[model samples]
Target chain A: MIDVFLDNGPAYLAGFRMTLALTAVAGVASLVFGTILAALRVAPLRPLRVLATGYVELLRNTPLTLVFFGMVLVAPQFGIIPPIGFWTAIICLTLYTSAFVCEALRSGINSVGVGQAEAARAIGLTFGQSLALVIFPQAVRTVIPPLINVIIALAKNTSVAAGFAVVELVATGRRLGQAIPGEAVTILGGIAILYLLFTIPAGLFATRIEQKVAFAR
Target chain B: MRTRMTRAAALGAVALLALGACASNGGGDGAADVDAGDFPEGSTMARLADAGSIKIGTKFDQPLFGLVGPNGVPEGFDVEIGKLVAGELGIDEGDIEWIETVSSVREDSIANGTVDIIVATYTINDTRKEKVSFAGPYYLAGQSLLTLKTNTDIQGVDDIGGMKICTASGSTPEQNLLENYPDAEVVPFGQYSDCLEPLRNNQVHAISTDNVILAGFAAEHDDLEVRGEQFTEEPYGIGLAKDDTDFRNFINDVLEKIFEDGRWVEAWEATAGTVLPTPEPPTIDRY
Candidate 1:
């Protein structure tokens, strides 16, 4: 209805850029960090496994809203003072998303048969070598779908960063809707469509990957 | 299995039809009475009263405007206004249900029926009037900066060039800085509460928002203070669905009454005086 964004396109676009950046950073960080935590989770040593387990459980159990609140509230106390919207959302989302990623990858690692590791060891490979050459490759293929799911989830969760003033999609919509009186539904709907433009394709891709993995099995 | 699927479809159809019926045939005469014949037939308030109680949205973090007090009860100026609006409708303040809104959810909360009205510190701007209706210039505020008491480098809005300033999303401060101070960098957080903690730790050079809200930070941390004159004029108002002219008129009338009867002054004094300098009361000048 009312096209307020047309008048304030620059501000909305600025917010959109921040949203995209935050999501990309969180997605990548979660993937890399979670992979390490998953490997640690699947490690044979009890202490290493315990440390990974603790991180997963603690992060998973806490609400992301609280985590974000903590990030804005507590992160600075730790000397991690992000000087711009760019770093605060990325760093906080990285921490929040990594917890879920670790769990997802750990499950993926579990799906990888132990016999592969055993075969690597039998062939005279070291533990790290066995994991890199045998276990990790197999685990990655198995976890692709779920990891994609997490990526989509992380993308959606990036909207929460708007609360911290991260210029993401939802915040953009909020600004537009507030700017226009009679067009909130239209404005918010446009935002939802934008989010779907990103997420629906990701969900479909993940589903397709799952189908392929299932077919392989 | 096919029969079950058909049944589910039928149920969904029924729900849709019910919603359509509610939308079309709803809105009793209460809101129409307030509209002074300016509103179209069947406004949001009439429909809401047909269902009972105005569902107002507000923040749970902004201290004096809208926030959860130490007792974990929602209390603040905006919260009080939400109650008073409902009371003017002859509904009890307790009957006025609250929908918790953050900076990101305020607009959608109204559009989606999550709230029938928004009493958040929502600025009524030309851009905002397109999507939702605003009742009055309920409060007059300005964008300003807050910094740690010990910091000396930044004096006001001007010194923040290339410095990190903390703000929340969907706020005017971010827009003001980028437009006026192109050299300044902004760090956005989800809530106003987030900005101050970072300020306390020196993570940011300054915190920017309405001077009134920054006053809350000043009250909380004796180390913080509002610096410089009020930089930008920000007029706060209540938000309702754009189609809800009946509801909007009723709200405007209530605002007018409060502004004149001195009750509004008492409310302002009881709440805003601690963080803000005692000033002349705001008048309802809704066009």
Candidate 2:
């Protein structure tokens, strides 16, 4: 088992690097894209709110694997050639996770009392300014916990990328397990450790920031 | 809150460590259960005979080879072969335990006693010999190219230059194809079925897998055809534990009996012959 670890350490590291890069890219993209959707969901216009609501409801209700299969299998009929494994996973991850992230931020926006938005309007701010300036800061504390949860979910969800044949951490671990027989536990455990080593720290940082800027309530 | 979170994290880490310890222990010492009950000693066959049942593993996906039937039972050429082997061991076919062994975990399943044998479309190779012994190269197959029905240019592997070629992940064919066609964009999927969509849509120019598997797919889809002659030979071997030489030899003898009695041909005709022409069975490599 130790031999499996020693032999595949570099491969596992490479896979971990890929996983981290995937998580980073998806995390940032989802945050940006999701924020826009959240803004749309809460906008005064009913059509924008319905459209955002439709997207979030549709994606959140569907399984991620099915979404991936649909994109790869069905997209070709429409002449959209999805990229190979890595980029395919990134696209699916961004699309799926943005829905959840949008919901989180929307709930956070709601948690900021209506009085805050009224105050923004009292200061002669427009709809965008009101969100960008007053309500968003207060909403951050409410969003932190669920946002962190979504981030963790997104990171772990990268495991499904293995189905598409990307050599991410789980797939690397699987290949190592196959190469060095009878080390399924060691290979999988090592992968879990590598994931925790980084993800736990990220979670801790989120918690720290959450505390420092915690809402008075 | 900090203490609770810290304690939870510590608990999780410790639990994971404990699981790892248990598995490593299983790998080292707990794998000797073949010696537990015995009508006679010195051979896995005798032990299995005493145990009165045998667990057989085969692929649960490949159609006409090892797929589960409409009845929710494993029914294919490999499954029938497993049934025959179980019957020879004095175990009734109904009593046989069918385990699904994917390509990558064949060795591990043998080592851990998850299955007494694997009959998946397992290609025998030297790299695998270090971990598990093989018996009875019962089926002869070869790597073949699969292309959309409209393709005319890709008659062989040489035409895959700069083509987007796909194969099942973790398969030797994938390794061979990637090594030979360095310029081809290699796309791999976990299951052979996953590759079909991309091929149908022309997202990938070609699919390469064992002829046996490709034949099954081609039979199912009118718009898909297996093109070219075989590029490489792959002998399908029955995998067993490395130390189980007696059992391996016994399996080889059973395979020989089936071949001699025409049961092998009958089994193939019942399943794969629906799509594939009859081919001579590969001879065994006794170790």
Candidate 3:
């Protein structure tokens, strides 16, 4: 197993780096977009709420593979070519994952007391100010663990990028396995280990944050 | 309870026997008549002949080579070649079970005894030889490029610098692009068919693989066309268990017979020949 990694260390590292890059970029982007969607879902205007709910439901219900297919294959028909590499993968991952992230944050926002929103309104603060300065700050604490879980899932979902010409971890393992069938098991095990390197740490971080924020309702 | 169990087992055996009989009756009307007495008593040929069935692995997606036909059985040059080999063992085409063997799993299927032989447009190479023996460089293919019919920017390999070229991952063509044309960006997919969508969308500038495979795609789609001569020689071979010298020699002998008696030409003319002109049969490498 060690020999497999040692022999092809550079290739494995390159793949590992791509996965990490994909996860980090998509993770941060989805958080921003998802938070916006969640806010919109709870916004004052019915049109904004309906739009956000429709966007979340449509993307969340669709399969990630189909989303990728649309971006890679169907997008060009509409002249929306995104250069079919890392950026394309980023677009697909962000679009698919932000919906789940939106749901998680919306649930967190709902968990906040209706009294808190009324209290913010009773004051001189407007709706946007209540959401930004008061409600969102409180909602984020409870949603951290779930949001991290979404990021972890996003890390694994990056493997889907393999089929779309983004040579990440799974694609690297497949290529190596094909080149050296004799060492396929070892190579696959090594890939599993590389994935755990990211996921396990994220899991631990989630646990730590959940405990840190363990306040009574 | 024991008597009931025994009766059930007996019924199952009878059903299987009936199915086998029906299969043989429906199979290969043009099956060759080879006498079992002509082969040595313990050879693979005699065993397969006496059993009257053979398991062969081949591609089910490659057009003009081994794509699955409308009737559910695969039809193409590879399937025809497999049928020809089975006929030599006195096995009918229907009795020859066609197992789908993708390029990546060809060696594992042979090593695990999942199939008696593989005729999946398998390429012979020194690395693969370490795991499984090969027979008959039956067809010589070469690495080439496929592009859109109206795409005038790329006429050949020289024009592909810094462009995204798609090929099957873990294939010889992928390796060729990586090693020979460092300037070209290689996008590897699981199967050659998977690259077609990307190529059509203009995500990939060209599809690079074996010339015959490219020709197969070109024949299917009006917008695609094969470009330039072959850059690397890819000798397609028959894959079987390693060190099976007798079986290897037997297959080679069968290939030599087909070449001489015009059956090889007939199989080619019926399948790949529709798209490609008939080339001289490749010389069988006995080694």
Give the C-alpha lDDT of model 3.
0.88
Docking class of 3: acceptable
Tell me the lDDT of candidate 1. Answer: 0.75
> For model 2, how does the per-residue alpha-carbon lDDT over B74-158 read when each residue is reduced to its tens digit?
8789988887777676665656789999988889999998998999988888999999999979988888888988998788887
The sequence of per-residue lDDT tens digits that candidate 2 reaches over residues A49-117 is 999999999999999998788788887778887776788888889999999999999889988888889
Q: Report the TM-score of chain B alone for all candidates.
A: 0.68, 0.73, 0.78
DockQ per candidate, 2 decimals? 0.33, 0.24, 0.35
Report how closely model 2 matches the true complex, as a DockQ value. Answer: 0.24
lDDT per model vs. reference:
0.75, 0.83, 0.88
TM-score of chain A of 3: 0.97
TM-score of candidate 1 relative to the true fold: 0.62
lDDT of candidate 3 over B139-233, digit per residue (tens): 88888899999899998899999888998876768877888899999997767887888899778989998888898999999999988777888
Residue pairs of candidate 3 with colliding backbone atoms: none
Q: Each model's RMSD to truth, in Å?
A: 14.0, 14.2, 8.6
Q: CA lDDT of A143 in candidate 2?
A: 86
Tens-digit lDDT track for model 1 on B1-287?
Answer: 99998988887688678657645654421132242133334765555555557787898888778887544557778887777676555454545787788877777787887888898889888767888889987888898889887888888877888888888765667667766887987776666677777777766789888887898788778898777777888788889888566677878888888788776777777776666765565667566
CA shift of A62, model 2, Å? 2.3
| TM-score, predicted candidate 2 vs. hidden true structure | 0.70
Chain A TM-score relative to the true structure, per candidate: 0.90, 0.96, 0.97
